[model samples]
Target: MPKKWFQNWFNSPYYHILYQQRNNAEAEFFIDNLCEYLKPSAEANLLDIACGRGRHSIYLNKKGYDITGIDLSIASIQYAKQFENSHLHFYVHDMRYLFYVNYFDIALNLFTSFGYFDTDYEHVKALKNFQKALKPDGLLVLDYFNSNKVLNMLCPQMIKTVSGVDFNIHKKIENDKIIKTIEFEDQNKPYIFKEEVKAFSMGDFKLFFEQSGFEISHCFGNYNLEEFDPANSDRLIFICKKAL
Candidate 1:
């Protein structure tokens, strides 16, 4: 397993943009869809794991749910804390050992952030941690890339600008894994970073959630909460429930 190289996000314009756009057009879609699906209590406590910058936390808090977000990145936590309403709080912590058993009524892991672990074993460990943190019969939602479609819709290179910096991203696929190389340029200086992981299929994730003690409640193809077909989906959203 390759080590995760996530440190570049702070100075990397690419990551900064992603962090700033944390509450972009997709925010309402994810918030409304998940809320509608879960029907969370006005008083329910929701956990946003890997919640970089707390966009989801802010939105859910506005809707009257008590939200607590956790992220491994301190910078991201700082960004998230900016939107803290009375009902929202954020911490820098690992989601793999949440330490809050039977606690959250709803938990969300969105935007393909769930697979940064070094190994499949560790991946499942985090899943079980999510299971542990959820109240019995609580809902857990995951928004991820549709692996099937990702394989076909793969892009080799793309350029985008964010936070007044230009980013050049390159992707390489090798043996069920994706290698993402990012080059950030601001004022003619270039800084580069890399991160990669083995991408698993939806069936694999379903088995993972099952082994982690969750039952699939729903799966969607897009941000609009539409049904997913393996061949055509741009996104894969899974709404699961803790097995009673």
Candidate 2:
């Protein structure tokens, strides 16, 4: 059987090249804002799920928190491991599997990382795993795109040039999922990859959270931590706690 779209694309070197413009400044800004809002304890244990290259984990560890970064991409994990210390670690992990049980003080699934699976069952399973990874009353910070706004302002096609490579991109909504197709050539070879994410709304997440034993304590619209506006916000940021 062939590999899953994420398993193939995310593990490819081209994936890093295509998204190389995702700067550390943006990540730091968001994480700083988040820490300001959350005000977690200095000894807090954080689980950064889908932590690409340990950017957030490194920053959090620098801020006096114990952090573990996990991602399915082996290359990304290897790169992240170079930064590990006593309080910071990186591991290759799948979100759908349980990594720890009631261990972390905080769990984060950031950067629209929660909606790639083919079935709702798989998505819920991942959420359950996240729930299991946290302590009683632990916080889960989930950041996802505002699907409604994305669809309303959908751009059908575009071209992005990075590292002297031109990536042709197409996007569409089908079967309640947003599909992004990327095509590019490198070293005289062409490649195509697809990313399919469920267009989950607030209502959808409420159900997912309920099933996973979490309750949303706050919902922000963006990195600034403003109130959520379904039709206007660029991001859907949820601060949840394990349900009693």
Candidate 3:
């Protein structure tokens, strides 16, 4: 769905038809690496901002960390609550303005979790919120889609089927932004969805993070922990530390 679809579209015909079950593979991939790098004590406090489905929090809790996940999607939070553990909890909360400040040993923003806001200011607010929520010398890990790579890889059209429903998808990019339309059909009855995503270069994020009081410590193109190659990498994993 388009930018507006994120407004309340999960209940719309679009999400119901296409939002398939996602495994913990993506979350586990990051958490395993994060644990090895940070070497957080068993008592370290973690906050998973925008934790849809609580995948990361669940995995971390199993690894003996104190975890809390917050997301605005009730549907996603509900699914997350099912796997709650003694040291893990999930709540429905917005990330644009977090409710806590200077409380977490670590904060995670993973799974291409950046850039859904209508404006760059909102996204900046998100980064500032992360800074405010982090303790002194706290670590924050950000995993986001590489804007350049995605835009360059943009395909004009795609055809596929899920649960017997056929889908025809098209994409258009102009002026550093992407616009997409999806048409879902079953028995020839068509259902349409549109999505708009802002494309920001890697430098944009680097400058933004610097202004938000964060210093880049580690940056990777993908979960494999390989060196960052902006043009070819799909995911950008950033490990930034609070400057203060």
> In terms of lDDT, which candidate is strongest?
2
Write model 1 residue lDDT over 25-144, tens digit each, in one string: 588777887778678888788999888777778878877889899888878787777787678999888877755899999889988877766677888889999999999978889888
Candidate 3 ranges beyond 4 A from true positions: 1-3, 10-22, 186-190
Predicted candidate 3 versus true structure: per-residue lDDT over 105-166, tens digit per residue: 89998876667767778888889899999999798898888887887788999886767777
RMSD of each: 2.3, 0.8, 2.7
TM-scores of all candidate predictions against the true structure: 0.91, 0.98, 0.89
Ranking by TM-score: 2, 1, 3
State how far residue 19 of model 3 sits from its true place (Å).
5.7
- Candidate closer to the true structure by TM-score (higher is better), 1 or 3: 1
Any residue pairs clashing in model 1, and if so which?
Answer: 53-80
The residue pairs found clashing in candidate 3 are 1-194, 2-194, 2-195
Which residue pairs in model 2 clash with each other?
Answer: none
Question: With candidate 1 superimposed using the best TM-score fit, by how many Å does residue 204's alpha carbon deviate from the native?
Answer: 1.1
Clash statistics: count for each candidate: 1, 0, 3
Instruction: After superposing candidate 2 on the true structure, give the runs of residues whose Cα lies further than 4 Å from its correct spot.
Output: none
